[model samples]
Target: MNTILKQFLLVSSIYLFTPTVDAYSLNDSLTKGTAALSSATQVKGEAQQLVGQLQSQLGVSQAQAVGGTGAMLQLAKNQLGANTMSTLSGNATGLSSLLGGSSGLSKNLLSNISSMSGVQSAFSALGMDPAMIQQFLPIVLGFFGEQGVGSTLLGQLQSLWTPAK
Candidate 1:
């Protein structure tokens, strides 16, 4: 039993103390991490710029800008199916943060937004005027479009949100 215990401790210590063989070198890992962080910072900066534009152009508060963006994105996600939404979320770095801190109404709409009334309710819950939604949708979505969110996705959103005029 003592010999068995000794063998176990020896194996355990060897496993614990050995250096891991990583696929990439330390310098390579640092370079990749730095690049990823830079990309994320750039995406976040662009998102902030859009939010600032929304606030300035629409005369809305910061909360309104964030909430409105969330509401609009949630509505689009509801319409476009999860796969497309996931792609958008993955590619658009700050998008997840914007969607995450939204009001309950916006988060609830993530699951279902089949009716116009439902859409209006979500926006209204964010304290947005119904009239403002018409103006707000285009700006938020257009920013995403400029950020390379894909023309196809933007087209679908435009079709859904735009009235039959």
Candidate 2:
């Protein structure tokens, strides 16, 4: 009888302690997963915010681009003959055509907006509101043009929206 009692006692203690060990590991895994998810969510939110900043900037920039291109085209028209003006107008139309892919110009602009990490971070560091930086869009658009970024962004958006045909 004494031997039986000691064997039963040992079995019960082992089973109880084994569960505590497993419970700890389970809790640790859950904690790590939760932390990772939280970090991912934050990055996504920041990325969306950065996208918004870019969109606002793009609207202003596109307007400026169209306006400037129009003005230049007009000036050239005034200085040159109808034939020369036609050439300049055709070129501007071609440039703007790239912006007007199937998804429209806004999607292309949105893509450019997402890729603007350096510009966004600079704005952040300076404590400058992205919306408040309207005056600077033309300058930034010029930079984007120089870098061949605008067309690249348009291409990216086009690929995303292009039909599988």
Candidate 3:
């Protein structure tokens, strides 16, 4: 009994103190930039594809138009192109262009807008000075954090709310 207990403790301690498996650092330029971009791109492409599929299936972008996730996903895919991340990471010029203007909207927001013209019309009706809001949408999107939604639906809700006397 004493010998068996000793052997069990020895084996238990060895198992408990065994060296952990060495894990490779997942840090690298391609991973941080290109790989991230590729993933974002693939995600966006898949979203766009899904949106396309859903649109074809449903014959309406209304449900998504109301919330706009699929559209936004495709847009992010476009702005953060799989290849562009490699350049944008180090180049101020790429960074500046990303921060620049309306052209940037071609990605997420624009596609969202395009998904349903009625949505665009509704926003236009709310008296959005398109010329202004168009340029800074991304900054605003950034302010909202990862989901990049809530505010848009909030805006829609606000539009629906009746004015107080």
| Best-fitting candidate, scored by lDDT | 1
Query: Residue-pair clashes per candidate, as listed?
Result: 0, 0, 2
Per the 3 Å backbone cut-off, how many clashing residue pairs does candidate 3 have? 2
Model 2 TM-score, 2 decimals: 0.22
Q: Give me the runs in candidate 2 sitting further than 4 Å from their true place.
A: 1-60, 90-165
Candidate 1 residue lDDT tens string, 52-106: 8898999986666665565566667777767866777665666754554333433
**What TM-score does each of the candidates earn?**
0.60, 0.22, 0.18
For lDDT, candidate 1 versus 3, the one ahead is: 1
lDDT of 2 by residue, 1-165 (tens): 699999999999988777676787866664443233222221222223322334465443333333222222222333343454344334333332222223332222222222234224323322344333333444433433443444654343233222234
Q: Which whole-number lDDT from 0 to 100 does residue 30 have in model 2?
A: 41
The candidate scoring highest on TM-score is 1
User: Any runs in candidate 1 off by more than 4 Å, and if so which?
Assistant: 1-45, 101-112, 163-165
* CA deviation > 4 Å runs, candidate 3: 1-44, 61-67, 70-103, 107-165
- Tell me model 1's lDDT, rounded to 2 decimals: 0.62
> Candidate 2 at 52: error in angstroms?
17
